[model samples]
Target: MVMTRAANIAFKPEHKITMLCLSSSGQFLSWADQSGSVSLASVGKNHTLDVKGNWHAPGTVVGLCLRGQRAYVLDDVEGLFCVNQQGEVDWHVPVAGGGFSLHEGPTDMAVVDALGRLLRVGYDGSPTDLTSQFEGILKAMYVSEFLVLSFEDGSVKALNGSQVVWNRPVRGEVGESITALGMDASGHLIIGREGYALVDGEEEALEMETWCLNGQGLLFRSDLKTRLTHITPGLGSVVCGFDNGSVTHYKDNQHQELLNTGFAVQSLMVRQNHVVVSSWFYLFGVEEGSEPWKIEHQGMPMLLESSNDGSICFFAGEDQNDWTEPEPIGFFSLKSEARDADPSELTEWFQRPDTEPERSAEEIYRVDETVENLLTEEERMLMEKPPVIGLDSLHAALDDFAFASPDDQAQGTLNVDAESLLDDLDDQLSSMAMMPDEGLFDALNEEVVAPIAPVPAAGEDQVVTCDEDGTAVVLLDGLGSEDPQNRIVMWSWVDSTGQEIATQARAKVRLSAGVHRFELRICDSEGQWSSDTIQLTLK
Candidate 1:
């Protein structure tokens, strides 16, 4: 199904994206590609994005964070760099053993390298090494004046200047890895693993269930069909996206389903009144009292950032290695109509005709009877007849035919010279069994080019009201139509009566208060035609 709202591409990098970061206010976006190229864009009004600057990193970027108009990038080979909006590096610090995570504090930034070293860098780019007491650190987060660390042994510790604030030992069986960790609005640490979570060292099993903690330290749990992949706290409710493609909202000891994407949800973000969900290659935006709108991406959307008032959202991610070219990051305003499908449409979508149904015994017998009735008299006789000769009898018959005299052969049913004809046939068969020429094999192995199908998008349907003149001027758009080779040579718009009205990609026409339909047909260079129809309702 096509997306109801069109998603605008902000910028496309030359290489595949490796990491993406969006600022807390959703005003600045920064991304890095596989080629070590980094770019920063400013999300302007109406969710429009403009690339402000671009720079090249020394190595592959592993982590990225944005603060205001500047970007903090951590690469695998180099340490870190604070870049301004004009592509200028404000400062560069050589991090030992490379970096894993980068977090921005109120005045300084935190960096965790590959060797479990935590360093805090000031605004002037001077990095002070913190304690390295913890080994095999998997993740580190700097919040307020404390550093929270999770280890490979499933242990967690919060430190304040070498002083242990609180520690939680491994809760599950030995070697169980931590899957998610975050701080709620009430300043409570929530740590999630495979089948459960730990709230202040208290075990909460979450198998086949969902849970949420409100701002008042109240915990709520609900039964679920699958495990949760992502959870985001909203204004008065908590939304959770599951591995089964369902997004559920829980609040006031009640739950309601938002939408199901039919694919494993990858990420989620919540704005004031909108919930943005990402699954596979599509992003869904759902708002109160409105159908959810979707925007399809060329790659899986891994990063989602939304504005404070739910007016705009920006998303970006790496390509899934299936496209001929890498996809760009995109931003869209939530005010547009981006509905995907309703409940009935989704039901019809999933019931595909993949295989034929089994036939009943009576139906099978009727099919056999119909086949028998279609056979000719000769075919029926051949089916009833038995083998005419055994193996030894066939050999005797051949021997007799080979040695028969000319007069005896004439008396038999055969008319041709059996011995001479057999000799020639053997010679021809021997020659035919030989291998063919290399050129002939090469011709057989040549690849065949398939015809390219043109995609004709007639744009969205429109609804308008007539002016005092009892007519309205409407614009019919077919610019979204495309051919892969950029070979679209002709565009035609036909009215309901099969009358050609326009021959351009876009046309303006006047109509009265009535319902009208227009069909847009596009022709490619290869003389292939594809068409799409759009409806317009006027009042």
Candidate 2:
């Protein structure tokens, strides 16, 4: 995403910013200062104007959460209060003892009082005594169907709605009361200041090389693989910027690359197809296979948030010669290019002769001859993507396609047994034709129904272990069918977090810990769709 950015002033206040939070709407950023000054900014335009409300609450603002149009804040002396976008105090309630941290759940909010009480609150409602209703819960996070709780001593418990599912003992002895409790990149529970422990998956400290920048006395909010200063979530993979001036790409558990930049990165975020990395004065927009597009920033940005549409981005930082108030630097219209060939794969692509095509011939997109003939010229052009070895390589794959690695090829010895597959496809097709339901044909809207094939079936051990470099490709192979429309004309590959990694049948993915469910939506030529889902667990 190469976006054109502009600089604009957000507000005029010199309060030392302690907490920064972006709203779920992607508009408006609410910040709390050391003096307990809460300000709001509507941040979707070319610039952020001072639409902030006036909140002069005393005492330090310990916790801040913005949901919808209200900002939920907790102050030492002021107590828990809901502030609307207009800066009006919507509701105020005293904290029985004192609250430290605030975590948002799927349906409600959970606050940790000093006495290990979990005070729950609704979106716009006042805080209640949910802590008194529960047992030994200091911090509570209700995720999915599991209620993950962290206690004062760094212990965690997962309860599946009133039933104890799992309990992880205290990670280590703590010298003081728990300061913070939250989840980490691994989907594991973490107790700040005390230590972090993996509650959901097995913990293997895969340490990678990291860097350190001088002067910042901040302890890591979450100490991941390295001293990663910036993080951008990716489909099946994660991009991390380390202090060592290097950008590392990881999938599964394998560390991928060394996009070495001498300057320390402050932020890493994905904009469309590009990964945006920010340094002290530069914002680098990197697309696969091309040099990173660098844009100079006025100064170090304390906070950067872009819209979901990727149309604009706003950063909270001091401009040159001004450290009084956080100015809004907006970048607009970052158009992103859709690249097919993987940038990670370009490391080898460049090693080959310059005259050679960027991708292998086998990578070209292909559909059944029936699909080619049935499609309009425009559809035909779009449908035939490039060099994709979808169905053509099914039989000849053993001889033509070189295995990604020797071990993978050794395991790839098994191919699709086409005979039984065709029989099964025929049987399913016949059954479908005989069924009384006419929904399938009606949806097709075609008088002549060409025989479509079943989606490719998985060979033995369809799920393979992470390769030597920590990448795993789930091959959509061994599947056989004879139905004309059954030829998969399109593919949708989605990761656990709903990020689509690939549109091709085969998915080369980086899986996080625990069970990751991915759904593959395949459409045949006749506008019919079929889905194949798989759950892969990464330790």
Q: Which candidate gets the maximum lDDT versus the true structure?
A: 1
lDDT of 2: 0.55
In the range 341-441, model 1's lDDT, one tens digit per residue, is: 54334323213335688888888766456677989999999988996867577556656344455677655444446678789789999988978899999
328: Cα error in model 1, Å: 1.9
Give the residue spans of candidate 2 off by over 4 A.
1-12, 43-45, 48-52, 113-117, 126-164, 169-232, 241-246, 258-268, 277-285, 293-299, 318-333, 336-539
User: Candidate 2's residue-wise lDDT over 341-459, tens digit each?
Assistant: 43333223212333655765566665447656778988877767676676447646545323355555465454445676688789999887856458876777868754745574322
TM-score per candidate, in order?
A: 0.56, 0.45
Q: In lDDT terms, how accurate is model 1?
A: 0.70
Local accuracy by lDDT, each model: 0.70, 0.55
Name the regions of candidate 1 deviating beyond 4 angstroms: 1-4, 44-50, 128-132, 142-146, 160-162, 195-225, 250-256, 337-539
Clashing pairs in 1: 293-338
lDDT for position 489 in model 2: 56
